[model samples]
Target: MISQNTISQVFETARVEEVIGDFVQLKKAGSNFKGLSPFSDERTPSFMVSPVKQIWKDFSTGKGGNAVTFLMEHEHFTYPEAIKYLAKKYNIEVEETQRTDEEKARADERESLYLVSEFANTYFQNVLHKTDQGKAIGLSYFKERGFTEDTIKKFQLGYALDEWQAFTDEALKKGYNIEFLEKTGLTIVKENKRFDRFKGRVMFPIHSMSGRILGFGGRILGNDKKAAKYLNSPESDIYHKSKVLYGLYFAKQTIAKQDNCYLVEGYTDVIQFYQTGIKNVVSSSGTALTPEQIRLINRLTNNITVLFDGDEAGIRASLRGIDLILEQGMNVKVCMFPDGEDPDSFAKSNTLTDLSDYLTEHAKDFIQFKASLLARESKNDPIKKAETIRDIVNSISKIPDQIKREVYIQECSKIMDISEEVLFSTLAQIHKKDYQDANKKYRQEQKAFEVVKNEEYAKPKVDVQYELERKIIEILMLYGDRTEQFEDLVLKEDEVSGDLIMEPTIQKARVFEKIYLDLQEDEMMFSNEKFRELYYSIIDKLNQEEEFSTRDFINQLDQDAASTITGILMEDEKYGIDDWERYQILPKKKTDTLDQLVSQTVLSLRCFLIENKVEELKNNILKDNVDTKTIMEDVKDYNDLKSLLSKKLGKVIGSYVTK
Candidate 1:
């Protein structure tokens, strides 16, 4: 457990932009930084970071919070992991509080797997450098591939010794659990027998975007007919190969800088290109490209230049992957190396300048590349040529942007020497087919929707009570400790006339106090559980602290509450700004209307509650036999109170009152 002082220090020192910028590529948007959401695949920027408030909100997904919560959401870090990461980032000396046994036992399984992988990463690196067999075999293989000692260390390349139980035995000796090792695919354990899975292989550690080791891809050094050439860690809780891009941790910053990524097919290709100073390169780890992996790169850039090997057959088979990239709305370009050269071989043989020059000269847009490759193969065959044109048309249709699809259709028309009318007709046909197919999927899901649609209790309705409670909470969070003047609506008797009247009295109180007094006088409790809990929490904090900080308060909250608070603040900020101000059409400021805002909001809530009470009292006659006379009088009294409240509420709503 981290000490309170340390947590406070971390929250105070660590900058949100500085922390989140490590993962997201943020650009200045007026006072805030805006970027494409890492949480969703939106072309426009919806992720906003307010450095002033020390919080961020992804409008695309509605996930908002302080920096700590950002880490928890984006990196899947445990609360402690996020804190420790920040403490490390800001160079804070974390002070520990001793944990009880039960607390220690509560640490989750995924984090344990992460620790095990981290340990394996360190252990393998040690073997590659420190041990005789590792140095001779693993180091030798990497060197032969033209990788330097610095390159080897940069990629965290390592070697696994040939002995069957070498890794498993050493891991167990160090008290690392065999269960984790087996799960991470570092060891094979069955029938009480254990052996190293990557034995006699050179290791390439696959990392998450944040530089944590998720798993390893090991290449067998020996050409044994019985053994596979490359072995990847099996799917586990931490590592999913289809979603994990090799070398993304190192490539992301450069990709963001260059505004393009060079895609390859293996670990060595990424490392080799990176070693050659082409740093914005990543591999799919030989897995077919997935939408998840494409979105990962999409965070940094919308452009991808896929580097293909010189094999025509492989290129033809991989054409579908190009459509996947296009479907993501990514600008796709293809660069094919010369015969007999892969990215690894090409980079190894050429100087940085030569390799860079070759890439610039050879890269072609996917439409042109696909058309040229497919068309050249069917140049003399009219039937195959027509089929090639349709194949290229299909690729163009995968592009999500309608405008881009049109432009590409024009390009495809010129390339295939076909009519624009024909191409547009074909596009319409493709879209129609796509819609039908999607509608079929929708029909299949209609049964699921049918089962779901009837549960009115499951569906949240328009809730005025909950909204009012939430508004009170939002107002408190935003202006809790600020002092303000309020017109307290006082009920009094007109003794001379023998009638009742309402009087307004001036009083000074903090914003939170004004809200608290109103609710307490009404004997009201928030109907929403979350808002009710938060209402008390906010009041207690405001009462105790002389100086209030929203960021600090949020940092101390549980994730759900923190997210809710941040969401409210962000949503308010979004609407609070009047965009027409850009046209010199200034709107009223929130602070200028604070008094009226508070009075009207509270009055509105009271009126709503009174109306409900009146309804309930009126409905009592519909119930079992009761005293009709007493119920009628009670209803009349409530109605009189409701009427008085409505008058005051109407005055507040109609115009601001200076009391």
Candidate 2:
């Protein structure tokens, strides 16, 4: 467990925008920062971070919280892991209790796998630097590859000793469980016998975007004719190779800053570029590109420059992957080295200035490169030439933006010497077929579910009572200590008509006092347990503290309560300033109409609950042996109160009428 004092220091020191800025690219929007939602695939910016509030909200996904919650949501970190991450980022010393053996045994399996993988990373690094055999073999190989000591240590490159049990034995002696070792694929166990998976190989630890060591990719140094040269950790709970981009942990901020990402094919390609001072590059680790990996980059930037080996035979096949990049609506360019050169070797030979210039000069628009390459293949064959044009058109259609698609189509027409009309027709045909297929799928789904599409399967009813209670909580959190003028509705007997009429009486009280007294008078409690807990906690803090800081208050609560309060507090900052300006929408604060806002919320809650009580009475009257007179009288009294409440909230959304 992390000590409360250390957690407080982390919360006090870590800026929400600064911590999140490491992973997300944010631009200033008035007093806040806006960026693309890291939790969802989106083109427009919907994620908002408020520096003043010390909170963030992803409008697209409706996930909002402080810095710690962002880590928990984005990285799937345990609460303690997030606190530790923030502590490290802010350079705060974290005070933690030692985990006992019983606690360790009951810990999460995924966390155990993380522990085992981390231990393996540390062990491998020790072997590479401390052992004579490792220095002579693994260190020499890295040095031969032109990697500096700083770069080697920065990437945490390491080696596993040649002996089969070298790693397994050391790990076992250290109290690392064999089950987790096998699960992380660091060790292979068969019939209780263990062997190091990457024996005799140099290790490159693969990390998640949050810098957790997920697995390893090892390169065998010596000539083994039958063994595969490069081996990766088997797909484990903690690592998915297809979804992991090599060097992203180190490259994320740079990619966002550069407004572009350099795509290479191997780990060395990324390291070589990064070592040479180009920090905005990542590799696919020699696997085929995946949409998940592309979306990861999408969270950072929308432009990619793919660096291909000059002599690669599969360059044409790799073009399919670049098309996936296009499908994500990104601007993609292709660059090639001189024949026989890959990014690693080319960067190694050229000066940094020369390398940067070469990349800038050689990078071609993906369409232009595709057109030139395919046209060369067509030569004098008319049929192949027509097919090349169609292929180019299909790639253009994958772009989600119509303007970009049209622009690329024009470029294709000019490059291929084909008329724009022909290309546009082909693009239209592809879109039409896509629409038809989608429509057919929708029709099939509707037909399959038609029998179940009765009133029972209709849209779920919105819970109005919950909303009313939520509004009360929102008011208490936002303006609890502040005094507001309220209008109390008092039922008075009309002297002439003898009918009860509501008379308004002006009163002044703190927001919390008004809400507490109203709830106490009604003898009501929040039906939602989370809301009930938060309501009392907020009231207690307000009454006791001299100064109530929302950020400090959030820091003291548990995860669920903090997230709920943060969501309510920062909900108004969802739209970027540019959006507000463009839409010409000026927002009115709840404080501006505090009198009506507070009264309306309380009255609405009363009206809703009264209707529910009346409903119960009606249900009781229907039973065979119930006394109808007393129940009818109770229902009549509820209706009278509801009618008075209705007169207050009838004009707004709080109207809760009878069934």
Q: Clash number for every model?
A: 0, 0
- lDDT scores for all predictions? 0.87, 0.87
TM-score of each: 0.91, 0.92
Candidate 2 lDDT by residue in tens digits, 1-659: 78889987988899999889988888888789998888887878888898998988888887888999999888889889999999998789999888888976778998899999999999999999999989999999999999999999999999999999999999999999898999998889889788989989999999999899999999999899887889999999999999899999999999998899999999999999999989999999999999989988987888999998865567887999999999888899999888888999999988899999999999999999999989988999999999999998999989999999999999999999989998999999999998999999999988876554567558778899888777887888778888887766678999999998777688888888888988787698888888898899889988998667888888777777877877776666775635676576776655667767777788778878888888899999989998899999988988977786687676333322221
**Cα lDDT, model 1, residue 390:** 82
Clashing pairs in 2: none
Give the C-alpha lDDT of model 1.
0.87
Candidate 1 lDDT by residue in tens digits, 247-362: 89999889988999999998999999999999999999988889999989988888999999989988987788899999988999999999999999999999999999999999
Error of 2 at 308 (Å): 1.1
Candidate 2 wrong stretches, greater than 4 Å = 59-62, 439-451, 455-459, 489-505, 575-578, 622-633, 647-659
